[model samples]
Target: MKYLFNLPDFPDSSFVMQITFWTGKQILFKNDALVEQSGEKGKPFLIPDGNGKVVKAYPKPSLPDFAPILIINGEKHRIVAKLPWYQLVLALLPLLLLYGGALGGGAGAIAAMLNMQVFRNEDSAAVKYFKVIGITVAAFAVYFLLVTAIYSVIA
Candidate 1:
């Protein structure tokens, strides 16, 4: 989603991370370029106070405790880039391809199993994203069954 915000810690008094339609959807990083949920997420949200500090000249809001201040312009904003179902489909796509390949040839199944390594919520961002999707638990079920079935058949 396009965002016009700023990080909390900055050298200059005024620094903003402005995003527009041309820039496309971008994620604002708090402390670094890559924002991993596990890492310490400094204040990185925006709230338009429209008061003294906020009204005067874009007071470069400090990142709020919560991240990703969505819908700032008073106009309802739809999530442009978030797709929880799509992630599940994407993660499962490769496996589906592997399943097809393995079904065709046992080697493909083995290769798929080897490649599709399911970890236990190692990536905090992934966990959070999945949790937001409301399909993490269900996704795990399908993932377990699919992987185990493939392995059971091949091994």
Candidate 2:
């Protein structure tokens, strides 16, 4: 059976991240948190009320915080700084282009939002901008299709 999840704020989003089964029941996980519970499975291993799935199902593997980065672009450019995810992305912006060129960060931003929920948020400025760009592109595609159809009919 199909199930639906409802979240506030991002009201238009369900964002069913990952689904995993335990024993026979189905659990819906989102943002590393189990948001929905279903099925009939008696307690076997853990707590009596624990439908088998814990709050943290798949724990993020601990990653070694240290790793040397070697960059070769005629001159050796070594990035020896430790930074967080956002910081790393920002820091690596300039280095995104390997061959010395404009690394189209705008395109990168749009492409990265390939995920439906984040990309479709009308409230987000980035999402709105991307939607405008997408609509413009779609308009062109439709126009071309119509023109082609008309040409075919005329010819």
Find the candidate with the highest lDDT and give its number.
1
Which tens-of-lDDT digit does each residue in 1-155 have in candidate 2?
A: 12233333234434232312122233443434555432334211111123553322221212221122221122222222244575334323322222322233333323332222222333676655555456435434544566578779999
lDDT of 1 by residue, 90-150 (tens): 3333333344443433333322222222221236766645443333334445556777898
10 residues in a row with least lDDT, candidate 2: 59-68
- Compute each candidate's TM-score over C-alphas: 0.19, 0.23
lDDT of 1: 0.35
- TM-score computed on alpha carbons, candidate 1: 0.19
Q: Against the correct fold, how does model 2 do in TM-score?
A: 0.23
